[model samples]
Target: MGEGNFNWSNEVLTRLISQAGLIALKLVLIIVLFFIIRALGKKLIGSAFEKYQKKNTVNAGRIRTLEKLSINVFSYALIFFTVVTALSNLGVSVTSIIAGAGVVGLAIGFGAQGLVSDVVTGFFVLLEKQIDVDDYVTVGGLDGVVEEVGLRTTQIRGFDGTLHFIPNREITTVSNHSRGNMRAMVDIGISYDDDIDRALSVIQEVCDKVSAEDSSFKDGPNVIGVQSLGASEIVLRVIGKTENGMQWAGERTLRKRLKEALDVNGIEIPYPHQVYMEKKADI
Candidate 1:
């Protein structure tokens, strides 16, 4: 009887060891398969995009944005599948776990509604081509150039070099400034004593010269006549159209050229002044 008891104990121990070894082996295989699949999937995605890029007449920036978003989505899916597979290999009931997760997700559906909205908004944003990488836009009360447009969030780099990540749902209205020709404008105030027609003539000459020389300009830096009458001077406005993202630099150059022209032509740009009287000694 003692010998039989020993044999039964050995048999149980052997079965347990075999089962544990099998589980370990399967886990290793799962990990290996996960990495192999991930690499192949990424390679396939890259090759597909490259082919599409050459064949399709879409903007490269938009294509790149889509590629990055696709990779993110692929990674998320792979991780989810890997986790589920690993759990199943451990003898866990994936169906039961998924059902439990569904119930819990429902329980907190109200709280998760924002996430859903974000995804939906992001989808529409992409579909409508509202914004693209490198596009300067104002949204969610922030002004910046878009760095990346993702499924959940959009990254924008501000003028001051601060990077901002904004949720898609919050971007209700987008003002894309890089869509067409940009306006380059500068306002110069000249003294009332200056000749309006002469000022206008010299300014137009300079505008004509700039428009001829600067290939960056799409249109003239012409003086738009008298913009306003200030307290001490008449404000003359120089307006020009330039390629997108060139407005600031173009405006600066235009302002410098106008100032030089005005100075050379003896047109006095107005400035604040005060006069003091000394009557104490006389009294």
Candidate 2:
């Protein structure tokens, strides 16, 4: 009887060890598969973006946004499936766990509604092409360049060096300034005594020079005659169409050149003057 008991005990120990080894092996396989799938998914996304860029069929910013979103979604999905599979291999009932989670999610559905809305809105934002990564836009009353468009939120970098992470659902209206050529408008002011025709001619010469020297100008820097007759000066307007995001630089360059030309031609820019008269009162 004692010998029989010893044999039974030995068999139990061996089975336990075998079971543990199997579980460990499964866990390792799960981990390895996760990494493999993740790498392949990312590589696929990169290849797609590269192809799109080469073809020039889609906007570069749009391609980049899609690539980033795809990679993120793929990684999340892979991780979730890997965990569930691993749990099931370890003798856990994944189906039951998922059902329980669903019940809990339903109970908290109201609280999670905002999160759902954000995801839905983000999906639509990407689908509609309303805004793209690196595009200058005004959304939610904030003007900035979009850094990233994630599933839940968007990151914008403001001109003042502030980074704002806004929920996608809150972006009700988007004004994208990078979709087409931007207008560069510069108003030059000269003293009223200056020759209007001469000033216009000098400005035209400067505009032509700028248009020739800079490749950013897409349309004319043509003068629009006198814009306004101010109290002390006459304002002349010059306008040009420039590549998106190059309008400010073009405007500055044009203004500088216009000023130099005016100065060389003896045109005076009027400034506010206050004259104080001292009358000698009969003492």
Candidate 3:
């Protein structure tokens, strides 16, 4: 009876050891396969991304978005296949697991309807070429330079050095400021007492000087004579068209140079002043 008991105990221990070893071996194989597959997948994806980047017809932002999406999709598919294969090797029934996963997925999908919508809209935005990375744009009352266009969010750097992360779905209207030539305008207010012809001549001379000096002055610092006659002064408008994204710089330079020239030419930029009258009090 004792010998029988010992034999039974030895058989149980051997079976347990064999099962554990099989599981360990399978795990090692799965890990090895995962890395091998991952390396190959990355190589394939990288090559495709490079090709996409090289295509001049495609925008850079679109290329980057597609590349990231491709890599993510490949990784998720690989993981799913690995898990299913590992389970199958362990003699687990996959059909029931798949059915259970489908139910869970349905619940998740219902909860993530907005997220799905955002992703879909982002894809359409890329396809439609409405905007791109590095574009200066105004969307949702916020104006900024686009730093990144992502799957669910867009990053914009505002002039005040603030970074705004905007949801893809919230971007309903986009006004691309850097798409074409931008207008550079400066309104110079001159004292009403000053000679209009003299003021106009001084401004024209300055505009000619600026046009001769700066290649960035595209159309002109041409004077749009007498835009407004304000209470204190007559406003003369200097308008020019400049290359997109260079308007602010051009405007700033033009203003500075024009101010200095006006001061030298003795054309006054008028400021608010009031007149006082001394009269006898009414009886």
Tens digits of per-residue lDDT for model 1, 1-283: 9999999999999999999999999999989998999899989998999999999898877887788789889989999999999999898999999989988889788788888888999999989999988899999999999988988999999999999999999998999998989999989888999899999999999899989989889988788899999999999899999999999999888889889999999999988889999778765
lDDT of each: 0.91, 0.93, 0.84
Supply every candidate's count of residue pairs whose N, Cα or C atoms clash at under 3 angstroms.
0, 0, 0
Q: What does candidate 3's lDDT look like per residue over 127-217, in tens digits?
A: 7777777788897789998877766777789999999988888989989897778899999899887899888888888888888888887
Give the 10-residue window scoring lowest on summed lDDT in candidate 2.
55-64
Off by over 4 Å in 2: 1-29, 272-283
TM-score of each: 0.86, 0.84, 0.73
At residue 116, what lDDT does model 1 achieve? 85
All candidates: CA RMSD (Å): 3.0, 3.7, 5.1
Pick the winner on TM-score between candidates 1 and 3.
1
Candidate 3, which segments miss by more than 4 Å at Cα? 1-95, 99-104, 272-283
How many clashing pairs does model 2 include? 0
Q: Which ranges of candidate 1 are over 4 A from the true structure?
A: 1-40, 99-102, 275-283
